[model samples]
Target: MSGDAVQIPDDRAFINFKNECNSEEGWNSNCNKSGITIWIQILRRGESIA
Candidate 1:
């Protein structure tokens, strides 16, 4: 599988998608581990992401 590289957000954030994860999944698995249901764009750094 291949396509245009996902541009690092304007903040020069680091993006990681192991086994191909969407933003929602990435956020749930990393940032917001609570049961709350909300959506937000999170720009993570290399050290911030798992």
Candidate 2:
């Protein structure tokens, strides 16, 4: 898996990881006190992988 992160305006940030099939699985951190939220995206059978 490969991962990257970026920060945007308004105290927002995003982090992501790409798997072998280009499916993304990662998290989002909005600079909040609570914490971050994680996510996963499974690629479809015919989806393009790049």
Candidate 3:
């Protein structure tokens, strides 16, 4: 499949999804950490900081 066809959603969608995730109990301590870590890795990669 083409990369465009598998593009990530916009920022608003990512925010909405993160908020929905935060509403779940225990999600903040576990899944959220992993999510933030992954996001940080992505940002670092984009910035060539990794």
Candidate 4:
């Protein structure tokens, strides 16, 4: 799974993940509280791994 976040919608958006968190809760509080929206994407192969 991969994830992305946009702190701001305009050209001046901030995306420094390291600065936000080392934990999920920390990131949520830091980014979500500040009006950032988080996006997640899951990548998988059509064939099973054998």
TM-score of each: 0.17, 0.23, 0.33, 0.22
Selected candidate, larger lDDT, 2 vs 3? 3
| Model 3 alpha-carbon drift over 4 Å, by segment | 1-4, 25-50
- Which pairs of residues collide in model 3? none
How far in Å is the alpha carbon of 9 misplaced in model 3? 1.0
Location of the lowest summed lDDT over 10 successive residues in candidate 1? 11-20
Best by TM-score: 3
Q: What lDDT does candidate 2 reach at residue 19?
A: 37
lDDT of each: 0.50, 0.44, 0.52, 0.44
* Candidate 3 residue lDDT tens string, 14-39: 99889865663332232345346322
Pairing residues by index, what is the TM-score of model 2?
A: 0.23
Better of 2 and 4 by lDDT: 2
RMSD values, in order shown: 12.3, 13.3, 11.8, 15.0
Clashes in candidate 2: how many? 0
Candidate 1 lDDT, tens digit per residue, 13-34?
4344433444455453334456
Put down candidate 2 lDDT per residue, 1-50, tens digits, no spaces: 55776656342222233232244333333344457644444557997635
Ranking by lDDT: 3, 1, 2, 4
**Residue 45 shift from truth in candidate 1, angstroms:** 40
